[model samples]
Target: MEDKFIYTDKERKLSYQILDELKDTLDKSFLENDLPMLQVQLKDSVAKNTIHRNVFGLNPILCSLQTAAIAVKDIGLKRDSVIAILLHQSVQDGYITLEDIDNRFGKSVAKIIHGLIRIQTLYQKNPIIESENFRNLLLSFAEDMRVILIMIADRVNLMRQIRDAEDKEAQHKVAEEASYLYAPLAHKLGLYQLKRELEDLSLKYLEHDAYYLIKDKLNATKASRDAYINQFIAPVRERLTAGGLRFHIKGRTKSIHSIWQKMKKQKCGFEGIYDLFAIRIILDAPLEKEKIQCWQAYSIVTDMYQPNPKRLRDWLSVPKSNGYECLHITVLGPEKKWVEVQIRTERMDEIAEHGLAAHWRYKGIKEEGGLDDWLASIRAALEAGDNLEVMDQFKSDLYEKEIYVFTPKGDLLKFPKGATILDFAYHIHSKVGNQCVGGKINAKNVSLRTELHSGDTVEILTSATQKPKAEWLKIVKSSRAKAKIRLALKETQIKDGLYAKELLERRFKNKKIEIEESTMGHLLRKLGFKEVSEFYKQVADEKLDPNYIIEEYQKVYNHDHNLNQPKETESAENFEFENPTNEFLKKNDDVLVIDKNLKGLDFSLAKCCHPIYGDPVFGFVTVNGGIKIHRTDCPNAPEMRKRFGYRIVKARWSGKGSSQYAITLRVIGNDDIGIVSNITNVISKDEKIVMRSINIDSHDGLFSGNLVVLLDDNSKLNMLIKKLRTVKGVKQVTRI
Candidate 1:
């Protein structure tokens, strides 16, 4: 049977327009050969019904044309990326293959299509940009930087076309992903114009009210703003002409999203915002004289107006890692209002507009070393084996604003703003960060948490006794430090877990007991452990005693062997204690209602995860025919659900039970004078709460301790935690 072909008039019109545009813009060879071949293949695919429109009913051919146009005009991608963008869908739909593309176009084109196909497959599995999927997406981007550029261009095209789309939910999702994912990617790639457009478009859909408000306000003030800018620029123009410098000036207003951010950050309305616009002075200078001309213009502008010394930013001396080079300053303008001015040459302006693509073009290379470094850092974070941390590190690294610091030997290093001394140590080497006790900044002794400032000379202090601690994760700001700390902590946990496992096995052998892996697994599950490693980790952490585990294992093993024995002949009490003879709880309706007047069954709150009143909880039927209430988020709850799911039952507090529940709080703070006393004072001030015990440990100018307190419900416990957080020197206070 012949397949039905579908093509809309709009799709045909777009194709013709794009083909005409490509004929004018692209090389003759591409227009005559590649373009015609692609068109034929696309038509065949559509005729076969292999290529279908997206969920929004967007024609695939039209989408490809629009995305390729963006890649060429906006992102400055070459024929390879454009070809990949056009044919990836065909390759994905099985109308074409990677090998076919490789033979027809080139390996570069095929590789980009492969990356695109991988991302598409990932989206099919989980459309949400979550932890592991996000990492995979980033991996695809890192494989070929052009893939990222093309994807960003594609997203921009989609965002623009979907402005009046009927699917508001899908629009919102697309806009959110653009804001959260693509905008930052654009910014990181140095595509400032695209970044602003993405942000503004996202705001238009996501926060429609705020977007229109800012846009309307900007529109209303445009005439006056322009007149004022001219009045401010005329004299500078005349002076620069008199100085014989060639430059053009324009007034650029901030985007609506930028204005909205300013309103929120400054806590004011549009009228209250100063510097709503910036004056960009583009200089026409040769490559050799670009910086000279920029600085000369800077001098002319500062001479004309009273400049704010602190607002001066000199990126010309050391361009941003993304290859953005511009000198920015804030000067007092005609109305005594502060006005921001940016000075750059034509090449710098292009780099500022196009980002990494223009950088590669000017540098005569296909990629940049800085981007490779960023990708390397991302790989390191992925290897750290924490999905959440990888996601956090990925986003943070994407939107990082860097600050340069100095080593003791005059070597300069760059780190993200807010990077701590420990971050610097890690950047120097993993060993230094691990052994870092403190550091000397500008000849002054400082703690590991001290934030580094630009141009500060730093000296790291280390000792043989110093080691990485769990608290260091909170102290450092850079992803490198965080990843390194996580790896170190994981290594320690593994070692401890292995040692604990060995100790348990040796104990079993000493007791003349042969461990059956099946019985042992069942015992761990019954005891609320999902994984053997976790059980060993708990034992390693001293939360579960090895002797107690052995005793439980022996009982479970003996009971499993006796399962075939005559049940009627066995003692009822022993059977009840061993087998818990109650019927399995219904998944949906079974609930253990706890109240003061409860009767008929013995139950107690579990100690493993202190489930106080007002806390969401579940009940695990113990091996002794009694139910033990546990907080749903209790660490042991997973193991119980995984191993002994039959024993799991939903639970809730039916009434305000008059029972004091024991809760432990872990507090970490600076080891300051009377810090412990201050913590105790906060607890003492709480009249309804009683402190049962407090155990403190101090090392290397920091203190971490556990405080066990008795409270009636989660409310008092939360209140107490809040007060403890407010204590002087307290950094983190969390429930354990």
Candidate 2:
């Protein structure tokens, strides 16, 4: 092992040989379409060199794709499918482009590759990476159903490579990502088999101790269960075989995570978890009579093993929202062990495995609101504008439960289950939302944050000058409202600056202060503003009060150090940042650190890893000298905070955020009267101050709501609470 690498003869054969075929297949597929452009990019690489040299060495990267190609071929991938598979990782690695695929393999191949490319394994920086990644996967897949399919194949290949990862920590990281991000995605797409394997494989690394224990338990009971399942299926098998039918019957145990979750939930032992295993019967029914005949097979199976009524899930009738179909029933077997059985035709099995996407056989079949429809909606929305709306809708539609509600206009609006009227309002229009005063659900006045159920018709109330309230954020769920509220808050701050400037001009005229841009410029510079707009925005957002600005202007015009830079001895030195401030991220000077969590002190996870328990961490002194703690591994902490490590403090959660921080909320939707007063009433308790201001901005039939203050942490905030939480004519709350 030269670099201590353990690649063997087996690895060399499996990878190199397989990749050669994959490369040839891709070349063939691309050549079958346009040849010149892709050839040039391909030729850019010298022989014996790599196409994606930056990310991996020529051989190793190629070898990974080759393994994928081999697996694809085994699964009967065609030319476009194999080429797309080969090009998958390279796109994100920046070794190639969609244009390369289009030029070489034709538009169709490029489309397929693009679909697969939609599944993200790449990285980026954001305060909420998992939520953002989830957002991206949701929106991307809505544009191409094939993305889920490709992700499935990618997971398959990654699972196989798990054993080869030498680093214990690295293995766990990869496995945990697979467990949380990939496995759920597989389940959402209805790829049960892939879901099972991925969850099991991930669990092996993530909870290895638990995994081995579960494995041992299953192994201990394997023989007896196998014998009993065989006997249980024997009668049904004989009946089907006697009927000249062809089918495959097999049993599988639930994965470790599933069993663990069940055990924790039900407070049960392995023996108490009787339905941990299932017997699946795959039938050979034809397409036309498939549904009817599948029920017949179900009837036969039920007759063989007495079916439990409560445990029977008739998904075979309605099918899952993802288009998964199969008759699932739990039966009392001869041993009295509960046996779960699934009876489905091969087509149903395919659909069950692939979700709405598996139904498309070729280009000709007319799909019933198929994957293409969803993908088209996503792409169309992206192209149509409103990125926040697109991102929100994508997240709502992609990951979990979805519901559809109607507006007064009779237009059907789809939303995540438990979506608030605020979400609905933002869905309508940002301007209308900004002006949203209130709303009526089913013709009865309901809070803007009220969760709309299926078929509920909402009539939004609005006001032209209505402002977004801070409390609505506590209730709204959809990101649309959050985004709108944020944008509106920004826009309102600018507008308010303009308004303040007008007011100041009048005051200057009354006071006989000369009106000159140069004088204003000097005053602004004295106040430490980069531009007049910033000054105006501060005034508009109430970060600068007109009285303060006027007094400050007088002082600057008259030489005032009373406020600008107070003596170091002043208590204000300990007070940092704007009061009722916009939490804009910045690089600060004067590093200092303190643990708010010490005794009854307050602290926060310094925007990196949101340091939970057991994370290697450190603290950094910020300009405010307010101690900010970060995971020692935080990227920014290493760069900005580490130089002065003395400021960093060790932080652990003392339970959760006390009381919910009175953080202001932003809601944007339709504009009508009373949106402000209504929302205000919700969080209007005496202890809660409006702080700086409430902002209302509107444009093109949309309104945005913004409330600024301070508040508690996330779990305390929610959509339902947002509606009842308060805001007038509020459509949605957007957090900036």
Clashes of each: 2, 73
Model 2 C-alpha lDDT per residue in residues 563-651, reported as the tens digit of each score? 45554576865654422221311221211223542432343456544443334456665777455556666667666653765665665
Listed in order, each prediction's TM-score against the native is 0.52, 0.47
lDDT for 116 (candidate 1): 81
For candidate 1, the per-residue lDDT at 673 reads: 97
**Span of ten consecutive residues with least summed lDDT in model 2:** 584-593
Candidate closest to the true structure, highest lDDT: 1
- Summarize candidate 1's per-residue lDDT along 586-613 as a digit string, tens digits: 1111224643334335677788887887
Error of 1 at 315 (Å): 0.4
